[model samples]
Target: MGLQVNIIKKLPGFELRVDFKADNDILGFLGASGSGKSMTLSCIAGIVTPDSGKIILNGRVLFDSENKINIPVRERKVGFLFQNYALFPNMTVEQNIGFGLLKSISKVERIDKIKKKILDLQLNGMEKRYPYQLSGGQQQRVALARALVVDPEILLLDEPFSALDEHLRNSMILQLKDDLMGFKGTSIFVTHNMEEAYQLCNNIIIIAGGSIDAIGFKDAIFNSPPTLCAAKLTGCKNISKAKKIESNIIEAIDWGCKITFNYEVEDSIADIGIRAHYLEIMVDDEDVNTFNCWVVFTSETLFRTKVYLKFSEPIGDEKDFDILWDTSKEEWDLVKDKPLPLKIRINPEKVIQINRN
Candidate 1:
């Protein structure tokens, strides 16, 4: 019914340590590059071995260092869609799709399954095309079809859509969602893109420096990340060192301001964060959680603009930019017409309190 992993593997700089259980759900391993997300997948797929601890899938011991039970890759029943797609260079699309089928099945049955997978994955006319003849997105689809045709007990996808164009990526995502909906076993999706993780997974595990930073339901984790690393990985752009000055207020040390929160501030509040979009550019200051901010700079994109504002006196350093306020281009146009030293408001409910700086 689930996959349980409690494994530790030593990497060059740090130990890859993690422990989590995921039910029959699409669980995302979210992290930055070189954060051991891919290594974790390789361990679960039996391509890499952990130094210690155990990995059990559906009550079966896949890897147990103490018991000396490390299942072979083919016997682990894992469908791994590697980052590179890993298509056979010499094999045609249909042959690659049929490579994983059981030899015990009749030749007719195998052909039927292969044909079905090819059609399902939209490789109808390119069945005889070789891997070198196909595009990146097409090769990715072929590899995915091959993995899915075998109907393995578990699925591991490492940045499955990293090679596709945006439109095709979205299309493949819908297709993958359909495939996962019918799949009954556990699926682990590894990705550094926060948006992809949010869109595809029911739950997410944030990894940083080869350590498990946070793990929980996707919405709960996004709404409230407990640690500083988790908050930053979840795209909280504005963060500052903080000290609780009152029951419901804290001083933003780096930003040179005091922020009030609706919830009681805890003594362990070492950092505070607010998403850039949560910041509001106001013409006048509010009674609470509002301060006069001087604009340091503005960076504009086609659709949006990032405005950096300093809330307090200049710290007289070259690296002294305070809060980042992200707004739409149209909204920036509206705000830029105002005078200097504009009032900025911090929505208390949107403030994220972090236990670690």
Candidate 2:
């Protein structure tokens, strides 16, 4: 079973018009806060109604504006794992997992089902613990078990690991991956973290300004972002204005260099985007477009080193540009002593240029 949404909605300051589809796949809803990610989830879960359009899931009509058909939230049979890990404070973990089955299943069957789910989540010994007695990760696992105990047709997770610290978040994400592999059901996950989206999702839908900014596989969406907004949201740190001189000739005002790309820009107005990871400090023998730059500042991360570069002349608003380069301990030892001038190159094909609408 999968999810489909072709919907339009209007609020005081936002307008949402999105059309998307997914198979029995893990679909990610990615956007910054207030970008309609959660609102879309609510609409799917029947907590919010759209002004018009239809929501079809698993060959069933969840909401249809034309037919004036809408299923109540309780009847949707959709599992929603909320961001807050909404477990009952008074109930133990097992009781919480077995709550929905109270009237439907026999007491013995209910206990068996709940115990099976607890074991699936590796929470075997924590069944008697209350919500307050568990850690954040444990509480989230219990919430997930409760959602799945009903054997929901589709699963919806909203920022599932946002509350955890970095280490715990990574661990939970891996656990969730394992659980999903074992469960093998359709899921829609909403998150704002790009790394999370890349790591967890099979497909990505970026919502910006209440509309679907872009949608596709992780590589397709990130490799060739359809718009400036999509490129920015995907962490394309360097976006510069460029004027096309001819089919492959363009002049970048920020870099003050007229270069010919190996690829063609078919648009009249283009915003060139370069991801920080694709750029590097220029070496002496580099044949690419070499620019003279002075290191303004530097910071090291676990994965890469962030170097801020200042051009010989001011380059518009981006006078200081950030370049991320992978470094080893030996390289760090050699380069960390003093400020050094740098050179960087960007692959032309990697330089995505989005045309303004």
Against the reference, the lDDT scores of all candidates come to 0.88, 0.80
TM-score of each: 0.94, 0.90
Write candidate 1's Cα lDDT for 173-259 as tens digits.
887887678778999999988888999999999999988999899998888888888888889999899999999889999988888
Which tens-of-lDDT digit does each residue in 1-357 have in candidate 2? 577899988999898888988788789888999998888888888999999999998899999999999999878888889999888999999998887664866888888899999999999999899999999999999999988988877889999988999999999999988888866567888998988888889899988988888888988888888888889888887777888987887777776655567666676757787786676455562655555565555688775576666556435555365334444545556666644565556667678777767
TM-score of 2: 0.90
Task: Give the worst 10-residue stretch by lDDT in candidate 1.
Answer: 311-320
Error in Å for residue 251 of model 2: 1.9
**Clashing residue pairs in candidate 2 (N, C-alpha, C atoms within 3 angstroms):** 282-343
TM-score, model 1 to reference:
0.94
